[model samples]
Target: MWAELIQEVRVAQTGVQILFGFLLTVVFQPKYGRLADTDQAIYIVTVVMGACATGALVGPVSLHRLVSGHRVKPRAVRLASRMTLVGLALLLATMTSSLLLILRVATHDGYVPYLVTAVVAWYVLCWYALPLWARRRNRGGSGD
Candidate 1:
């Protein structure tokens, strides 16, 4: 379980780190100053979500370090797994908002929110719904 937790953390950690790094750079871009107030607010919220995702994805390492010799591998793994889920959820929100802001700025279309909604639905289905369905199936299968 510890090994699995470490492996999962590594994947999410890298993704969030890269995303957060890019989010940090957006503020330095010249066009950033030209964005509307609402867009700037969205950017700020998205950056915060990115930061939270980064922390949650990286939490298992700190957790392990703090509880290494306590003989609590199972509990630690469970907590870390929960944190990873939370991180992924935050990442989804961050990506959705980021996409919304970018598309709004680039296209100035009235359909940006609808497009973002569709994308959000896709993410929920792909990331959460399918996995949850699998879990239910696996857990409720016949004892045979």
Candidate 2:
């Protein structure tokens, strides 16, 4: 479980770091000055979310380093797994809003909201629902 959790965190950590890096550069772009205040606010929130996701996803690495000799590997692994899951959730929100803001800016069409919502729903189903259902079904069939 620990190895699996670490591997998952590594994948999420790379994605969050890349997203956060891109968000950090937005303020310096020339076009940033022309955005409306509301857009700017959304950008800020999105960046914050990215940062938090990065922290949560990377937290397991720090946890392992700090507790390498504490004889709490199982507990630490479980906690780290929870953190990674939370990070993924935060990341989903950030990416969804970021896409919404970008598409709203680029297209300015009435369908942007619907498109964004659809994408968000897709993310939810792919990232969470399928795995949860499979877990429940597998567990229930174990005859415990």
Please provide, for model 1 over 30-85, each residue's C-alpha lDDT reduced to its tens digit, 9 standing for 90 to 100.
99999999999999999999999999988989999999999998899899889988
Q: What TM value does model 1 have?
A: 0.91
Colliding residue pairs in candidate 2: none
For 25-74, candidate 2 gives per-residue lDDT tens digits of 99999999999888898898999999899889999999999999999998
How many clashing residue pairs appear in each of the predictions shown? Answer: 0, 0
Residue 28's lDDT within candidate 1 is 100
Best candidate, TM-score-wise?
A: 2
User: Which pairs in model 1 have colliding backbones?
Assistant: none
Clash count, candidate 2: 0
**Every model's Cα RMSD, please?**
2.2, 1.9
> How far out, in Å, is residue 127 in model 2?
0.5
The local distance difference test score of model 1 is 0.90
Error of 2 at 78 (Å): 1.7
Q: Which 10 consecutive residues of model 2 have the lowest summed lDDT?
A: 135-144
